[model samples]
Target chain A: MPERRPKIIGFCCEKHGLDCVTLAARSERQYDASVRLIRVPCTGRVDGMHILQALEDGADVVFVLGCLEKNCYYDTGSIEGRKRVEYVKGMLAETGIEPERVEMFNASSSMAWKFHDIVSSMKDVAERLGPIRPKGGGSE
Target chain B: MIVAERKPLDEIAKMIAPYEKVAVIGCRSCVAICLAGGEKEVNMLVSAMRLKNRKDGRKQSLDGFVLERQCEKEWVKEVEEKILDSDIVLSMSCSLGTQTIGDMYPHKIIVPGLNTAIFGVPEEQGVWSEKCLGCGDCIIDTTGGICPIARCAKSMLNGPCGGSSDGHCEVNTDIECAWYAIHERLKLQNRLELMEYVRPPKNWSTSHSGGRRIIVKEDAKLTPHQKRGREVLE
Candidate 1:
């Protein structure tokens, strides 16, 4: 059997989070191709439902990348994002799912290395967990 | 407002296990404000349950809905068809809402998704503290707007009991002594004399301790003839 490619989804804030990813690509840094990036106005806009939905939709690992807490473009956007992520993690733990499958990371526009680290870490998680398999197959 | 907390996911899963079609309903009332049951909560719960079912290889159809107020028959009637079509309903509201659905559909199974916690006010963004006991009496006027029966662990009518120390309740150090607060509040209002006035024994008949209570307004209720006319119209 062919080695399975882990599915990873990242919700990135348009401000510093997206900037970090853009700079990483410009610097000729390569990350896992299996990872999909979603751009949002701010990390605060990401709801707990979004993270859970990603897992239900076959993403083995999901993450929220936001601006650094103290310097969020929207003042407390990243802080709010972390709270939601933590809330979802609690729910996942209660439901007997691997809490590590979901995570939150902070980044600045100039931190290309942070973007690479976040992607690499999430990719590692996805590969380790494999796919969240439904009874007969994938999600309905 | 009535505060509630969601039940454990495993318990909720077990309640709907025997049903093929399950409707997870929420209310936009007190439970919503407390972040226990609302539109977002209903969706999040359904998604989580679906994931659980999928992992366990249990095939169940789940749908989510929200009502303006679950305890009101008018809003419940709006989703009548959805209720009748489902094998069971998981109500994510307070007990009043759960009982409303249960009473509306006697034949269908209605399970409570949340434990009605308290009659409280939100102290902050995520904190809800119980402030009312629904004792069916009002005595806060003498106590500086704070109900001792609700806030105090002993519900002592006169003052703090022997358990009070340093303005805190012995039951829990985190809880402030209700009488201590009452004294401070009264002192602030310059009504410290009210503290000296002894209060009489409370009448428990007006409270839940006296069986279920009901209030009837003659003017608001329809007469027999009017009820008949409305019944015919329906």
Candidate 2:
């Protein structure tokens, strides 16, 4: 029997980079089409609880896709999101969840080609990791 | 007010393990002011418990709610609706508040999530020490506002043992000798002669050891007109 594919939830910044990966996937032959994407105004708005809720809802992999550092249209949104991601990673480790399951990526709106590469790279990483447990305490 | 600290997460998790539906309760009175049991604590613990449950595949349900004063019967009644739905209640209040919850609802299991410490003031933002051992009698006025029983390493009633040197206690050089504090106050007031009088040992019998102390006065218990009117204010 074939193994079940993981649910990779993507939170993309709506301002300048939300569709970069989508456009890239359409033009590129190597883009991964199995990820779910939710577009928000900016990564800065992503709260710690949001990442926790995603994992609690059974997401095997979560990605915060935002504009490249220093290039975010909303000033520090990308930077803030990256900091939030780091905090969530520490929290996940305490609960026996692998820190790699939660990730943050940066891409420019014009880098549609690079975005495609990032998504494909993300899919490959998720394939190796199994299910993620909630944040407090648990295993496997 | 009382000072308290939350129990370890692992220990608290074990306390609520038997129940599927758990309610994390917090007290906003003493515990809140002391920064121990409050709404933020309730939210954090609830989130942690939910995450733990989800990982275990046990399908647990959890919620959080806080009352203003858990020690009082009236304030505890405010959470009546939430309590009815939970299989167990984990109270993040002082032991008095926890016991009050238990007394109010004998049918449900009320668990304490804090180890209640003695009455104390905020030493800093997050630290509170035992200022008043509840020694039955309060001698703040006589001791220059500091409690010897609490600040002194020996809880010495007379203080600043012979070991106190250069204003520091012998037990620990880092600590300021409580007797030195008293002596300083006495010298400043030109009442150094008061130190010549020997003080008696503390009377612990007037404290919690006597099983709940009470002060009652027939003349001060009520107002004259209210007793005669027999009418209550709604």
Candidate 3:
């Protein structure tokens, strides 16, 4: 059998999360190609459904990257983002999925290393989890 | 307002497994304010169910919509087309909203995504407590506006029950004794004599035991308006 390349999704907030990614790019630091980043205005804008929908669309793992807690440009946006991630994690657990498949992270615009670490951690999780089975015979 | 919590996802998944197309309906009224069955909840449920179906290879198609209020005929009508199109409906509203949708589309299957928790308000950000029992009669005027029927463990009308201790109910230490609260409130207002009035047995006819209850506003009916329309037609 061939290896299953993991599909990962990151809901990145425009303020700090995406800025960190851009900063990493300028520093010649690269992230895994398997991770797809969808930029949003704020982490709080990423609803619980958005995370679940990504999983349904074949993402092996999904994470929300937001500004540091209490440092959100929208005051409570990152906190709201964390709440949404937690809510999705609970739902995933209830549906027999690994709750860890969905996660939340906080970082500052200057912290490219932190963003890279987040990606690497999610990549490791996705590799171990393998491709998410769609509806039929993917039994955990 | 009615408060509810989402039913476990596994239970909801099992409930809708047999359906091919499901319409997940949400309400933007009380349940919305309570954060149970509102637009966000509707979207969450739909996404979760669809993800589950995909993982299980079930091929079930789930769609979602948030109605103004599923309990109203006009609002229910807004989603009539979608409700009719789907094989089943999963309601994220309170029990009344679910029942209203079921009544509107008698031919469709209706499932509730939330369990009606209680009639209460948020004490804080995410904490909710029961407040009203809709006991058909209210004596809050004399009870210093505290509802013993809903808050007291024993629903004692005259005063605190034997179980009340240290301003707490015997049933749970976390629950403050309603009678004690009423007493304190009445004392502050200098209306302690109101407690001396003996209340009559509650009229249960207005409650669930008396069967389906209805309230009609006779004065609010538009009979005169209809009569004027008829005269204009003549």
Clashes of each: 0, 1, 6
Sorting all predicted structures by TM-score, with the top scorer first, yields 1, 3, 2
Whole-model Cα lDDT per candidate?
0.92, 0.79, 0.87
Q: Which candidate ranks first by DockQ, i.e. highest?
A: 1
Give the higher-lDDT candidate: 1 or 2.
1
| Runs with alpha carbons beyond 4 Å of true place in candidate 2 | A1-131, A134-140, B163-166, B170-174, B188-191, B215-234
| lDDT of candidate 2 at residue A28, scale 0 to 100 | 40
Model 3 interface CAPRI class: medium
Evaluate every candidate with DockQ and list the scores: 0.63, 0.17, 0.59
Compared with the true structure, model 1 gives a TM-score of: 0.96
lDDT at residue B59 of model 1 (Cα atoms)? 86
Instruction: Give per-residue CA lDDT, model 3, range A1-140, as digits (tens).
Output: 88667899999999988898889767767877788999999998998878887887789999999999978888899999999899889888887778999999998999998887888999999988776665345553
> Please, what is the TM-score per model?
0.96, 0.67, 0.87
lDDT of 3 at B224: 82
Candidate 1, residue B216: the lDDT equals 96
Question: Per-residue lDDT tens digits of candidate 2, residues B1-234?
Answer: 798987876678788888889888898988988867887667656765676666665677888889988999888888887887899999999999889989999998999989998788877866776777877788766766777888788988876678899999888898788878888887888878666656687678888877888888977787878776755552
Q: Candidate order by DockQ, highest to lowest?
A: 1, 3, 2
Model 3 alpha-carbon drift over 4 Å, by segment: A1-5, A14-19, A70-76, A135-140, B221-234
What local lDDT score does residue A21 receive in model 1, on the 0 to 100 scale? 93
